[model samples]
Target: MSRIWDRMSLNFLSEDISVKSMKRSKQKTNVLLISAVCLSLSACGEFSYKRGASANDFQQEKKSCATQHKNDADVDACLANSGWIVVSADKPLFAEATTTDNKMPVQMTSDDKVIAEKPVDPLELIAVGSWWKTGAAPNALIADSEQCVTELGEAHQTRNNMSLVTRGLVGCMSAKGWFALKK
Candidate 1:
């Protein structure tokens, strides 16, 4: 009887230990699940951040090339003469413009064979704000001449502003039959 009682007590203690270990395992699993959920939520939030211009915003801007200036070479010359510097004459011509401070550099590119070439002062281009012009003899060649000065002043990152200018110039170049390459 004594031996039986001792065995029963040992069995109870073993069962109690098993229950405690199981509880600990469950708690660990819960912690891991919570951590995973939090991490996934943070990642999702980051993926949803805004990046580029809106479709409607683009429609509102005035286009540079009129029906007459649609020829590729003529368009290229028009842009180059207006202040866009040809950086690459390859399949996609690359070019850059500068801010008035000469501190920021905005680049542009073309899609097809590069014909015209010229050396440009990026700093002087930006300082004078010549990239923002329209008409046959535009003073400057801005994608949206109306907003060039305002946007540059409001831009927080000078480099980013440069990039925006470069993109606009590339688009103008592409319109002129020059393939604008992604930098």
Candidate 2:
């Protein structure tokens, strides 16, 4: 079974406060009820999973944060203070990062400083948005990206050969005049 079920089973076993004395049918009902409650409570968690700024940015930020924070909370705090924002569809904590036209200027605040003049590149701007199909091959995308990044003279690469590109790489591809096309 999955970790969720395992954890729920453990919880049910541990909360054997009244289970031992109950009849078998009553125990099954109790287990189901407890499981439902546990699932519901878990689903109600306030904290949402976060995707850090960009591929390049996250790597850099994580390297910076690693020295200071051994705990996940501390690391998250450090990243937040450093201006990293969360990008998740299941739970949205803030507004989308970019406007319709990425090249247009938008205000980006970092370390209490407002950057109003910098233009958001199409890739960076659309990183949280959409363009191409989601089922693209990793190798093809990486090959295309390498060609584009080299052309733009930007140094951004995937860490651990992961599926997604760094935000900087997206911008690099855009700079090289490549838009992610749908198949």
Candidate 3:
């Protein structure tokens, strides 16, 4: 009778340990699943081409431009001139550092006052916007951009002077109407 009682108690304790272990495993799995979901949601966002501008204005201008220009570059220039700016939900639309007083921000210079920053080129803005939207390889874009800088002729590349020629490349793409769509 003593031997049987001892065996039964041992089996019950082992079963309880197994159940506790299983619960812990499930808890760990649930935590990991929740973390993964949060990470994915954070990465998700959309792109837009307006900040201070109205959507109705964009649509109307876009419709007119579509009818007017056969070339995408021409259309883009028209939109840009009309004050359409590229913006992303994930990033600040107007990230320009400014003082609270809203004065023209400038960098100290040796000479007379000069504006420290110029408005970022629309083409370059679109490049960043498109990257997040399309998830395309930047190397591929740079490869495609080689043709754009070919006209410049014979830039000496050195270890310290490695240049992407971004302006020329983005300009070429903009001329081709290769704007990135948001995901």
Candidate 4:
């Protein structure tokens, strides 16, 4: 009787240990699954994945023509000569031509300051706009010269006969040479 009782006790303890081990394994699996799901979600949320260098954000160290050259006017002239257009002033932005035929619009302030200018290909500008509107980047409108160019092109192509100021950005981009008015 003593032997049989000992065997039965041992069996019961073994079964309990097995059940605990199984539960532990299941919990570990659940944890691993949750971790994987969270990682995937985080990756999906990331914008601007695998993007190349952005010319829109010009760094003084890497992109500035000032130190190597002399004066803002000289730098501006150098950029203009290279076919880079000043797309924005507040941030000092510029764009290069994707093709030779396209010309950047000249920017003239009310105070008669010449800011910046460059030549830009029309089709390339349009493509860039479309890419911005539906690209993997975080925000499209932040550097969207293409949108302005496309609108201007459409206005002109439709023969809307709008004023140069109102003709949309594409037409402005299409004009012969763009310039940034100096302040």
Cα-based TM-score, every candidate: 0.25, 0.26, 0.27, 0.25
Model 2 error, position 55 (Å): 26
| Root mean square deviation (Cα) for candidate 1 | 20.2
Name the best candidate (by lDDT).
2
The residue-level lDDT of candidate 1 at 101 comes to 42
Relative to the true structure, candidate 2 reaches a TM of: 0.26
Regions of model 3 farther than 4 Å from truth: 44-183
**Between the candidate structures 1 and 2, which one is better when assessed by TM-score?**
2
- Which of candidates 3 and 4 reaches a greater TM-score? 3
Best by TM-score: 3
What does candidate 1's lDDT look like per residue over 3-115, in tens digits? 99999999999999999999999999999999997786545221111125343432222136333487766754554454443223243223333223444544656755545
- Among all windows of ten consecutive residues in candidate 3, which has the lowest summed lDDT? 156-165
Cα-based lDDT for every prediction: 0.43, 0.54, 0.52, 0.45
Those runs of model 1 whose alpha carbons end farther than 4 Å from true positions after fitting are: 44-183
Worst 10 residues of 1 by lDDT: 125-134
Candidate 2 wrongly placed segments (more than 4 Å): 1-135, 160-168, 172-183
lDDT of 3 at 58: 81
Choose 2 or 4, whichever is better by lDDT: 2
lDDT: worst 10-residue window of model 4: 125-134
Q: What lDDT is obtained when candidate 1 is compared to the true structure?
A: 0.43
lDDT of 3 by residue, 45-147 (tens): 5223654657677879878987989896787667767756534345554222122355765666687865455654422322233322135466655544455
